[model samples]
Target: MNTKKEKPLHSLFAGATAGAIEAFVTYPTEFVKTRSQFEGKRESPIAIIKDTLKTKGVKGLYSGCTALMAGNSLKAGVRFVSYDHFKGMLADSQGKVSTPRSLLAGLGAGMMEAIFAVTPSETIKTKLIDDAKRPNPQYRGLIHGSVQIVKQEGLKGIYRGLFPVMMRQGANSAVRFTTYVTLKQAIQTRMRTGQNMPTSVTFGIGAVAGLVTVYTTMPLDVIKTRMQSLTARQQYRNSFHCTYRIFTEEGILRFWTGTTPRLVRLMLSGGIVFTVYENIIAVIGARSPDK
Candidate 1:
């Protein structure tokens, strides 16, 4: 096995590359997911997808591919890099706090990732989704929208709702990486009979972990979506203040409004993500003669 320092950056690089490819495949569903989170209505995420498609046709669903490709690649790169770095850091932390230590590592990894990349990408992505569905669309297309955001709002507009974004992404990634690591370790233990634990087990664990992360931190996710969808001026007036106000005023249940659809979405999305990610990694490992 390659030591932390010695291991190729293939996992991180490949993970990001895979994520970008995957993002395009499911970008339409993702647009629906963001809108559902923001609208905070009791409607299902699928309903949101259907409605958008009906109103705007298939063209409407893929409103923000540019934002997604840029943000998601950065997000994926940061996440993979952080997960690897944190994993290395925790390797020396000790036994009693092993899992907890790993969780913390994952948390730190995710937090930094949210700060630098994921949050901003989420903001741009959300705005484009809303913009496409808005009465008077601000952006004609992804590139045009991006350029306008940069021109009118400056780079910050591109990163409108970074706070709750951090919270949502940080929480999501923490659960994902930690769960993946834990499941990998557990499966390794069961590998004694020359029979490995089924890939289903790992994928299932990842899906459950994803659902937990998404639902637990859902309120923040909602806030992030709403904040991002706002215009730059509207966003600047009071994003954090509004987040708190929404929580207090909307009833806590409001935060969980679209949670069921989100759960289903995450399970399917995350399952595909992990399956593709692991297979890619395995292929990379196989080609390495030293392995």
Candidate 2:
């Protein structure tokens, strides 16, 4: 067996690289998801895509991609780095990572990401995405938008839906890492081989993990997206208020606004990111000092 140990920095790099890749590949779906959340309507994913294309063309599908890519890079990096660090610290007496501990580690990682990376990036990206119809958008770019947010609403505005974001992310990590570990172990056991696990297997497991995360935490995602995507003049004050209004005015079904696009995006992203992450960890471990 390969004896090298994983390093924190490895997780950071792996997560960032994987996140960037996922962002590029699945950004169109993400754009559609954000738009659906903003619309607060029961529109099909195809209808959203057609409308976006008719209105803004191909470029519209990738709007705010720069910020998204950059943000995802940092977001994934911090998440995986923190997760590995915490998981290593919480390893059992036999140096094994139990499923429960893995879940806890994932929660820690997600919360850390929500605080450090997700809030700001999501705020900026959603602002840009929702401003598709405006001729003169208040936020010209990511950096400018960030500055204007602080100038107009202060630091609190930068993190408008922190709680829901945390919830969504927490659920994302808890389910993703735990499921990934379980699936990987299962596959390894089934293979009955001493060689390294295949990249394809890791990717498939990651996709399944992503699907679980989305289904389990979609309500929180809907709430978070609505809270973040509101225009300056919109009425929703906060997460709870937004949820209340959505349920009372729009109906409960509205909360699943972008479920379709979200599922597709998260599935690809989850699989791609985790697969890359695991492979990178292996590489890093092979070269680590402890090895």
- Each candidate: what lDDT? 0.68, 0.80
Q: Which parts of model 1 have CA positions greater than 4 angstroms off? A: 1-8, 39-46, 93-97, 231-239, 286-291
Writing each residue's lDDT as its tens digit, candidate 2 over 58-131 gives: 98788888888988999999998888778877887667887888899899999999999988888778878877
Clashing pairs in 2: none
Instruction: Put down candidate 1 lDDT per residue, 1-291, tens digits, no spaces.
Output: 112432437667666775687677767667766777654355577787788888898878778877787777766767767776766766753432367767777788778778887766776677778777777887787677778878877988877776677677777877776676676666666576445456687568767777777777777767777777755455436667766666677776776766765666676656656666666666777332112
- Candidate 1 to truth, TM: 0.85
RMSD in angstroms, all models? 3.4, 2.9
Top-TM-score candidate index = 2
TM-score of every prediction relative to native:
0.85, 0.91
- Candidate 2 lowest-lDDT run of ten: 282-291
Tell me how far the alpha carbon of residue 7 in candidate 1 is from the true structure, in angstroms, after superposition. 3.1
